[model samples]
Target: MIITDTHTHLYSNEFDEDRNEMIQRAIDAGVSRFFIPAIDSAYTHSMYDLEKAYPNTIFLMMGLHPTHVKDNYLEELQHVETELSKRKFYAIGEIGIDLYWDKTHLPEQQDSFRKQIQLAKQYKLPIVIHCREAFDEIFEILEEEKSPDLFGIFHCFTGNYEQALQAISYNMKLGIGGVVTFKNGKIDQFLNQIDLKHIVLETDSPYLAPIPLRGKRNESSYILNVVDKLSEIYNLSNEEIASITTENSKVVFGI
Candidate 1:
């Protein structure tokens, strides 16, 4: 019953007080694998230290998040490239256009997204995307960069059925999480029609907590809530959902 949380921020300051306890809670809940996404150079040390603390359970990814993509983005990308040269990273991640917060950086966000995709291909690593309010914009770039080697997860995917099929066309798997448990989170409506192979579980924790805990801080242990919802949606047992999604994660992340 090993489960994988393909995206989470255990390194986040929000968890500073009970990080270890929270991780233990998740482990107890059958979440053995936790893939950590990087925000920027600032969190690099914390991410490495977290991996060191839970070497086997915790995995690390490096990228400049779109919301963080500002005037100094070039220097940030340099840090990502330099880190890749220094050691192994599971992916170049949490990268893509974010028009929700501020559209002013849309152009720079697109440029950064493309450059990072190139970096991912160069390193033969998967990418974890963070897209918000820019589906058309993000898909536009993905269309241009589509290739046999360009592949990754559409993290925290909250798009339509057509978008799901479209993302798969580009070799990406949908990262399902807390949203699936929300009563109005529409993906649950058509999810059963989609293949489980195209899906993976995430919490995006300290964020989108599943209902029963929505609007509250989320943790990987709560990932079980997501699994339960998915089980109901796909008409399978929790173990069946967990095993398949964990396997799907391995296929995407190569872990």
Candidate 2:
């Protein structure tokens, strides 16, 4: 059973001490593919180092995260463009509007989101979105940018059935993560209603750890907890769930 973690920060400092061990742990747990999301220029080198370390397992995306859309966002976007020109990237993502932290940068966040969407279209790459407390806002831009070329995954999706439909309408596969295993995470309630094809697995590790390990730092290995939960929700075996979601991930990432 080859599982795919479509979104994870394997390069995050959280795993600095046992990075290799943690990754190997996940690999042993059947997670062979790890799609790494870009935060900002600050972590670019670490991301590259991670790719070099696990060239086959680590896939990279380049973009400025919404939360990191500060004053110098233009320069960061330039860096994204430069990197895209230099080499191949699976996607342009972990980008979108994040109003939970601070609404002061909403305008800049929206602008950055739209610009990055454009960049994704230009490069013919799927986008990985990082939306928080801004589903309406994110959907607004997605509506304006809707096109055959505008497609991606809604990373860490935490919206309702209606919003899920809206995201699907825009060619986005909902990224299911540890939240699906939480007792009150809510997405689990209607997940089966959305076909398995519209779903992909993620851990967002070092964050949103599934129950049994909830409130603690998460790792990709814990994604099995998520797969087990999804098994119950979709009424499929764990291997089937993993196989379908990993295949769905390939559809979105084109890997």
Candidate 3:
């Protein structure tokens, strides 16, 4: 029952009122490991604070999110590089192309994505990609950067069977989260076709909450709902889903 939430923003201001209590709720529900993804330098201090508070359970990733690629992107990437040089991080990510919000920064996003991928290889760390309406763009960069060292999880994967296979070819494990529980969330249709080893569980908390909790704020504790849905999808018990996904996460994060 040691569930691992491979992606969650427990440091978000959304939890400012009861951060500790909310985390404890998730802990009580068996989500003991929380992998925190960085949006930019602004949240870096808060991420450190979170790690200090829960040293054992909190793991962090450093990167510049695609949407954050603005005029000051180089400076932000410098911050990412500086942080990586200073300490240990499980991965370099929550990074990749995000064309959903606006395509204005597409070129910059591509540059940032390429640079970050190189950084990941340099550090020998896995990458947790955040792709939205940009699979072809993400895959293009990944194709060019393909190597033995280019490996990680595809956070909040929402692609088709063919795309899943493509991502797997690049040595990525699909990060399944609350989206899998949605009625129209198509990944579940062919998820069983993909082996369990290629899957990892996540919540992307305060973002994509699963069914029954949809339209509401998500937390790590709500990951149990995702586990229950996965249990039905794979015809495995909840414990099996938790154990297997957590193990898969360790395979990527090496934690």
lDDT of each: 0.94, 0.94, 0.95
Clashes per candidate (backbone, < 3 Å): 0, 0, 0
Candidate 1, residue 68: the lDDT equals 97
- Per-residue lDDT for 1-255 in model 1, tens only? 999999999998899999999999999999999999999999999999999999999999999999999999999999999999999999999899888889998888999999999999999999999989899998999999999999999999999899989988999999999999888889998999899999999999999999999999999999999999999999999999999999999998899
What's the residue-level lDDT of 33 in candidate 2?
99
Per-candidate TM-scores read 0.99, 0.99, 0.99
Clashing pairs in 1: none
Candidate 2 lDDT tens digits, 61-139: 9999999999999999999999999999999988999988899999999999999999999999999999999998998
Model 3 CA deviation exceeding 4 Å by range: none
Winner by lDDT: 3
Error of 2 at 202 (Å): 0.3
Model 3 pairs in collision: none
Q: Which residue segments of model 1 deviate by more than 4 Å?
A: none
